[model samples]
Target chain A: MGTLYEDRLAEHIGKECPPIEAVDTVCPETIRHWIEIMEDRNPAYSDAEWAAGSRFGSIVAPGAMMQVWSMAPHWPQRDLPELPIAPVDEVLISEGFTDVVATEQSQQIHKLAKIGEPVTFTVKLTKVSDREHKTRLGVAYFVTFEYRFTDPRGDLLGTQSFTYMRYRPEPESESADEPAA
Target chain B: MPTDWMKPHLKYDSVAWEDVSEGDELPTHVREIDTSLVVLGAISAARDFYPVHHDKDAAIAAGAPDVFLNILTTNGLMASFVTNWCGPDWDVTDISLRLLIPAFPGLKLTTTGTVARKYEEDGRQMLDVEFGAGTDYGPHCKGTATLRRP
Candidate 1:
């Protein structure tokens, strides 16, 4: 199973996943929701009047909210579309590396997330570990993926490189040895 | 959305790029994590429905002690931390984060940062800041963020 999946993962290297368009634009309602939850009081993000006088000349979404725009909706179960990393995940899961954890995320902003603007995200599978490595949870493989955010004109807005560790869960009996201290 | 959550407090109008120097320390900011921040930040704010971020049982099943904050929320907190220190006139041009540990609920997340470099690129003033957030378990995450001033 390990060798079979490992070879499958090797085939996906450097392939770009299909781009996903945001269901909503960069609008005030969504921005406000993020700001409220984050408790961020930045005038540039909420106060239109104050923002108009600033360098941005208008209210802008939080730079960190870039990824939120393109998230897949939570309701209305349909034939689930293959997620960007689903293919790779399938290979990992076949070998019992079921649980995943995000380890690193780095992003570069080229354009601000302006209100009413729609953003699209494109992901590319960059790297897959050649061999398994032992992790605290169990054995795992590290996968690296890159995300590119663009606008309607295809102008680059930002880019993020994210890394996740796909690991097998320890047996219940083994974990129970150190139950929550 | 209700506007009542908006706070009235404001930081400085802006930190001029010309005035900032390398090695300058930013004001430390602290936040108390609760189950609400973890869940809301995942589902409502970030639109992330990852179970480990909101369900303790799921997290424990996956080997975590409890529900923990997600990467998107940490990114938001990092942005807020920097802007609160440098004010709002600047825009984030880059942010790189490495997760060292899980930020579980009931811990005080203390964040600190320092201006690492000052330079000009493409006619815009740029600053690279090294920052990190930590809990009682040690560093939760740390990275550098680049800010551009117009």
Candidate 2:
């Protein structure tokens, strides 16, 4: 009747992982590519002159784009080396840890990210908990992580708080498909 | 004269200082959650790498009735809906959201918000907007957003 939560928590507790950081360098091409890929038509992210005239003075990356920037460093690229990443769900899943679900996401934008401005990201684990949802009849563990982004001048650009719930299969009688309590 | 940046055009203002009432409903908009777009969005947002969002087989194996939307994507959709209505000039000061149900893939999500309250804070005109998004299953997400006109 034990759950994967207990073992996952024990492995993560008191473990230290290298933080992710990058330069503030971004270009119009990068911004355009992201917009095109995401199908975002916001002028603030497309038209340079329009963005320049605004309070930000240039096209800024979308708040959601920052989340991608934060994770980029953790991933391996053919060009960048020496950047260590602590494998989380994606990698762990390949190694037998399964049942990852996004529980929550929140973001706060302080300043706009202009083209060619290097925005750095740093991530850290904040919380982890094991819970049994009787209603769903699932064994799940909640993991919370914090990400901070800053401009080259050390000014706070934004902060993102992400919460994830990873669950596992239960017995037939205790399945998540059961009727609500 | 760069396209006459200051050129005057037909202007019609809807909400006046006194016309707004508490608990008034704002116009709602529907955003179809394209499964492919949702998966791309999840990767772009660096959200939890849950296959229920990207891989159909993984989702089915994970015990999900089917592939579903990610919470982060839902929040972004809600924010985008409000921002689209409020125009590009408004700044989102705060958003408090709660996930109430699971949104299955390919289902169109209807996002609506109401003017919960209107008041002046720190000499700025602010509106307390509450938003809810749902599909056929029920309400998927609910939250309150604090918006200020710049």
Candidate 3:
């Protein structure tokens, strides 16, 4: 709704954000914890017996847990990287779309991850919707990022494309029938 | 527990691609999106430090009545909904879901899928499944998953 958004914000599409930090080699402890929380004891994930009998022939991390390796940390660290996604979000929030919500996510699980294989990810801000859309929440724009997961040998483990809607919520008018934003 | 007819055979705990055809239906799985999973399963596991996920106050400030489910958790649950039926041998190559409802605590998200199209591609046995998940807020996610069956 402002000149800044029309003139400057639209210029951010196709921008390349910084790469996420490399993680230490993948370990079973982290995968075990995730499996415990989701209660997804799919023998492939936890039961040694199931995995050994399965096609993989060994324990494999849940493909959905691919994001845990790259998301924001639970605690703030002084040496935290600049968060490759900051500029994309900060620019939107600066435009008065203070409310943010995950709108869609698409992931491709290429190869099942084996325990002890290292994983790292790099993200690129692919698109920032140029058009303003309205929803029950308010006015918003969509932000999309593509992530590539890799192992130490630079082999791709998987890939995910996530999109979020950044909007200014009008909580007073929450309605299910409201038009799409 | 699954019966003998449902158990996986040999090395793959899944249905063979030859046995499945287009228009086949997938079983529905109803999973709870409770407080613990929202806070512990979704946020803690993903290490998403956003207070909006753990702190109710922060979530309220973010225009949410309570802490809500995160995408990572939803992805996991949705994938499971499919794999749980396909068996451990099936491969989920692509899963795309769009969030329409904010899954709040105490809400149970039920998932249902229909085999939309089954075909061969790139030397792989593949099928496209259309899936949807719903809460009281209406459909929370609508998406498609592409899978390879052995």
Winning candidate number (TM-score): 1
What would you estimate as the lDDT of candidate 1? Answer: 0.82
Sort by lDDT, best first: 1, 3, 2
Question: What is the C-alpha lDDT profile of model 1 across A1-181, one tens digit per residue?
Answer: 6575456888888888677777889888888888777778688778777766877677778878888987878876435345557788988998888998888888888877778788988888888878776665677788898889998889888988888888787753433211111
lDDT of 2 by residue, A8-112 (tens): 443553343354455326656655555543444456666666667877687777665566554443344424332212444643455443555565666776765
How many residue pairs in model 1 have overlapping backbones?
0
Indicate which candidate wins on lDDT. Answer: 1
The 10-residue segment with the lowest total lDDT in model 3 chain A: A172-181
Instruction: Give the higher-TM-score candidate: 1 or 3.
Output: 1
* DockQ of every predicted complex: 0.51, 0.29, 0.42
Model 3: lDDT to the true structure:
0.74
Instruction: Give the winner by DockQ: 2 or 3.
Output: 3
User: With candidate 3 superimposed using the best TM-score fit, by how many Å does residue B66's alpha carbon deviate from the native?
Assistant: 2.1
lDDT tens per residue, model 1, B40-142: 9898899999999999999998888999999999988988888877777787888998887789999999999999999999998899999999999888999
Candidate 1 chain B: 10-residue stretch with minimal lDDT: B1-10
Q: Which ten residues in a row have the lowest lDDT in candidate 2 chain B?
A: B3-12
Question: Which sections of candidate 1 miss by over 4 Å?
Answer: A1-6, A78-81, A171-181, B1-7
